[model samples]
Target chain A: MTVQISDTARPAAAGTSSGRSLRNLTYRPEAGALIGTLGVFVFFAIFGGTHFLASAGTAAWLNVAAELGIIALPVGLLMIAGELDLSVGSVLAASSMTMAIVSGYWGAPMILGIVLALGVGVTAGALNGLIVTRTNVPSFVVTLATLFGMAGLTLGLSRVITGTTSVALNPDPGSKAVFGTLIAGQFEVAILWWIVVALGVGWMLQMTKYGNWILAVGGDKESARAAGIPTNRLKIALYTGSGFGAALVGVIQTILYNGAQVANGQSFVFNSIIAVVVGGVLLTGGYGSVVGIVFGTLTFAIVNQGIYYTGWNSDWASFILGVLILAAVLMNNTFRRLALSHAPRSGKKA
Target chain B: MTQPLLRLTDVGKSFVGTNALEDISLEVHAGQVLCLLGDNGAGKSTLIKILSGFHAPTSGTIEVDGQPVVFKSPRDVSAYGIATVHQFGGTFQLMSVGRSFFVGVEPTKGWGPFKRFDKGLAGEIAVREMQSLGITRVTDGKRLVGSLSGGERQALAIARAVYFGANILILDEPTAALGVKEATHVLRIIMQARAKGVAVIFVTHNVLHAMMVGDHFAVLIHGRKADDFHKGERTREQITDLMAGGEAMADLEAELAALEASAGSTGRS
Candidate 1:
C-alpha cells in the first residue's frame, strides 16, 4: 500500500511567548557618537582659529557630513541586509554623466535629467542584484566587478561624448535654488537633500515591513526564507537604495558645483561603510540604527574638517581617520557585546 | 478515505548513482501521527527531502487528497498546506519575537507608501498564537528568539506553523538532542497540535516515544519499507529486532554453530 499523507495544514503555532525587555546598555555607541561629535567640536573650537566655531565652519562640516550621511544611510541598510555596494562610486559617476548628457548636452528638461539619472542608478543596482542572485556569488565579488566595469564605462562613455572629464551644469534660477542652493543660500543644497534623504530612508528602515525583512535576512538568511521572507528581493532592494542614494549625491554634486566629474564621489565607498560601522552597525549584519549612522557621519565629517581647523598637517588627516575608524569600531564592539550580554532573556517579551 | 491528505507511492531517490531510498511508500491521515523509524542512513533523509519538496523522487506519484500533484518548488509544497519544521527550528535570532512570528507575512496598516508594519497587531497575533498553544503568559512580547530556550524555540516554531495555517506538520526529530525536561515540553506541544485536529508526522529514533504516542508505527529499513504496524500490534523488542536486522540474526546463528564445531575439533582452546 502507498503512504498516505493528510492535509495537516494548520497555522504555525504561536511563536516564542517570552516577554523580554531590551538588554542593558552599559556603554551605548549612541552615547559615544554624541560625545565624540562634541569632543571633536570642542577640540577644533578651542585649539583652532576663532573662525573654527563660526557658523560658516559649522556649515562647511555639516555640508560635508550631509553628503556623506545620505550615502551612508543606504549603505548601512545594505549592510543590515548582509550585502555591500562597492559600485556606489561608479553609480554616482554614471548618474552624473546621465544628467550631464541629458541636461547639459542634449538640452533636456532638468526633470527628465533627474529621472534619467535615478533610472540609470536603479538599473545599475538591479543588474548588480541580478548577477549576485543568479550566479550565487558573494556580493563583494559581484559589486566589485560592477564597480570597475561601471567606472570604466563611465570614463569611456563620458570621454567619447564630451571630449573632457567634466561636465558644466547651469540650472535655471528656479532649478538652481532647488538643485544647487545650500543652507543660508550658501552651503550646498545637497546638504538639505541629505537631510531629507536621511529622514525618509531612516523612516523606511525603522518603521516599515522592508526594514524587518532586511534585518531578518541579514541576521539569518535561511531562517528568513523559511519564515516566508523574500530575502533575495530584500537584498536587491537594499542595493537599489544604495545606488539611489549615491545617484542623488551625484545630482547634488552637479548642482552644488555646476559640474560633474568621473573622479568625484570616490571616497564615499569606504567612508560610508565606515560611517555605518561607526554608527553602531556591525559589518557582519543584523544590527545598527539610522540615528547611529547619522551620528557616525557627523563624527567622521567633524574629524575630517576639524583637523583642517586645528591647522594640523592636512596630510595627517588620513592617519587620523585610520585611527578613528579603528577606535570607533572597537568601542562600538565592546558596547555591543555588553548590551547583548545584558540583553533581556529569551523567554521575556522584549 | 479521501486518499489520505498526502500519498507517497513507491518513492525513490539516489545520489551520485547511489540509492538513498528505494521503493518507499508512506501515507498520513488527518488527526494521525505516523512514526517513521530507521537507523541512521536508513534513507530517512532521502524520504524527507522528497516529502518536504526540497528534492523530487526519481520515480513516484505524490497524491494530495486523492489527486496526483507535482510540486515545482518549496513554495508549491507550501500551497498544499504542508510545512516542514526542521530540527533546529529555523527562526531569525536577530529579530524581535513579534517580528519573527510575522516575518514574511506581517500585518500591514494604511496603504501605498503610507504602508507600515502594524507592530501592535503583529504583537497581538503573536500573543494569541502563543497562548493558543498553552504558552498563555508573555509579559513584554518583544523578546528576541535568541533569548529563548531550546524547548521554547521549538514551541515558537510550532506555534508559527500552526498560526500560519499549516495543517500537515512534519517535524524532523523534534527532540533529538533535548534534555528530558525539554523533550517533554516538545511532546506536550505535539499533543497540542494533535488536539488542534492537525495531522502530525513525527520522525524520530526514540522507540519508547513512538510506542507511547504514535498512533501508527512504520519501520523503514535501508530506504525500503520493512513493516507497518498499528500502535499496539508490535512490542518494543520486536520493533528493535526488526530494525537491527532480522535477517542478520538468522545468519549469525549458523556462523556461531560452525565456529563452535571448529573450535572443539581443533582443540586450540
Candidate 2:
C-alpha cells in the first residue's frame, strides 16, 4: 500500500498544488451564483444610478430579498434533496389567511392565529411528504396537486369565513414588533429572519449528518436506502421545512401589509424556484450550496426592484431575468462539468 | 466447520403468485469469499435484496452467528455488520469524498447545537482508509466522488464499509462494469477485506472473475441452487454451463450443429 501511494499519489499532488487553488475556487458550487449576483448588482447599480446604490434603494431590494430568501432557502434544500414543493405559494396564502381570519376576522388572540397559521403550513408539507413516499408518484406531480388544491381550499375557506376575498389585520404590539415592524423606517424586519434562516440552514447542510442524508437521498434514493438512510423520513422533513418557511413568510406578509389576499403568494412559487436555480442549485437535485441560494435571492431581488428605479420600461425586467437565468444555469453546468472531470493525474501517468 | 457467520434456511420470496426466490439455504463463513453466480433472471438480485433486508423472506429463517434474526429493513441488516456495495459503488456522485464516505453517520465534534461534522478528521480518515486499500490516487478526500474512476469509487465504498466495522461485506457485481485492471484492483481489495476476517458475498455472472477470488461458489438457476461447491471442484466450463441453466448451453451447440448439417444437405440437393 505504501508503495502504491508513493508511486501514484505523489506526482499528482506535486503537479497541481500551485495552480489548482485558483481553479478550485472557480469549480466551487457557489462560484456561478456569486458571479451572477455581482454581475446583476453592477448592472443595476449602473443604470439605476445613485438611488439604486443608496440606503433607501438598498432597503427596497433588501426587503424583497428577505421575504423571498426565507422561502427560497428551504425550497433550495428540497431541490437539493431531489424533490419539489410547488404548494409553497398556496401554503403562504393559506397560512396568511388562517392568521388573518383568526386574529382579524374572528378577533382571537394573536398567538392562536400565529400558531394555527404555522400549523397549517407544517401539516400541508407533511401531507405532501406522505403522499409522495407512500405512493410511487413523483413529488413534482404530488406537490403540483397540492398547489392547486390548497389554493382552492384557502380561497374557498376565506370566502366562506370572512365573506370576502381579502381580510384586514391589526396586529397586536408584540407581534407587530417581532414580525411586522420596519427597521430604521426602511428595512423590513423580515431581513433579520432571513439572516437567521440562512445561517441555520447553511450550518445544517455543511455540518450535520442530516445534510449528508439529504444529499445522498437526492443523489440516488435507492442507493441511499441501501446505505441505511431513512429516505422517506428525510424527504418528509424537507417538505415540512419548506412548508414552514412559506407559512412564516405568509405570516410576515399579513403582519406587514395589515391584510391578507387569496392571490398574494402565487408569485412566490416560481419566484422562489427562480432564486434557488439562479443561486446555482441544481434543478434536478443532489447538488447545491446554501450560500448559492442566498446570492441567487439577492440577485433576483436587485433585478426585480432595481428596474423600477431605472427610467427604462419595467416590462423589460423579466426579459433581463430570463436571460440571466439561462446564463447562470449555463455557467453552473460548466462548473459542474469541471468538478466531475477532475481526476488525479498519477493514475494516467502510471 | 465452525458456525457460519451468516446462515439462511429455506428462504423463499414470492411476489404475488410468482416466486422470485424459493426455499434455498446458504451459509457464509468469516474470512471467506462466497461467489453467487447466475445468469439474467436467475434470482441473484432477489437473494441479495433479501440478505440486504430490502425485502423480507416469505418463508424461512436467517441466522447470524447461530442466532435467528428478522431483517425488516436495510438498517436492521446493517446492524448485523453486513455492508452492501451496489453496482456503480453506490457513492453519491455529487458529494465530496469525505462527505460520501461518512454519509448517514457523520463524525461530530463539540456538543449539542454547537456540535458539527468534523470535516478535517473525516477527510483524514477517509484518505487514510482508501490508501490502505491501495487506492493511492485519492490523496485528497475533498475531491468529488463523481471525479473518481470506477475502481477508485469501488475502493472508496469498500474502504467505508471496512472503516465502519462491517463484518460481512456484500459486493453486488462489483467488477461487471470495470476494465481488466480495475477489476483486478477490486479483486485484490476483496482479498484484503477477507484477510481482515470480513466475510464477502461476491455476486457476479462472470465465471472467470468469480473463480479469481471466490473460496466457495453457488450457481443459481431459475431461483434454485443448481450447484454449490468449493473452489476447484468444478472447472470453468461446468460453471458456465450450469449458469446457463444446466442443458441450455449444450442444447444450443447441438441445435447449431444440426442447422449447419441441414443447410449443407439442402445446398447439395
Most accurate candidate by DockQ: 2
DockQ of each: 0.31, 0.47
Docking class of 2: acceptable
TM-score of each: 0.84, 0.90
What C-alpha lDDT, on a 0 to 100 scale, does residue B236 get in candidate 2?
98
Candidate 1 per-residue C-alpha lDDT over B1-269 given as tens digits, one digit per residue, 9 for 90 to 100: 54587778888887887888877777888878889988787877777777777888888788877789887777778778887877877777656668878878888899998898887777667767776776644433455666556776687788888887788888888888788887887888888888887778888888877776688888988888999988899999899888878778779888988899899988866
lDDT of 1 by residue, A1-350 (tens): 01110110000001112352333223333545545555666777777666666666666777788789889889888888888888898999999888887898878888888889989888888888888878889999999999889999999999899888888877667767776786565467766677677667766776788878888888888767766678777777777888888898888788677778887788888888878887788787876667678778887887888787887789988887888888888887776655443334344543
Candidate 2 chain A, which ten residues in sequence have the lowest lDDT sum?
A: A8-17
Index of the highest-lDDT prediction: 2
lDDT of 2 by residue, B95-136 (tens): 989988988788899999989888788888999999889888
* TM-score of the second chain for every model: 0.88, 0.94
- Over A1-350, each residue of candidate 2 has an lDDT whose tens digit, in order, gives 33532322221122122455666767667778878877887888789988877778888988898899999999999999999889999999999999999999999999999999999999999999999999969988999999999999999989898889999999988999999999889888998898888878988887778888888888888888777788898888999999999999999999999989998799899999999999888888889988888888988998999998898999999999899899989999999889888775344633
Candidate 2 lDDT at A309 equals: 85
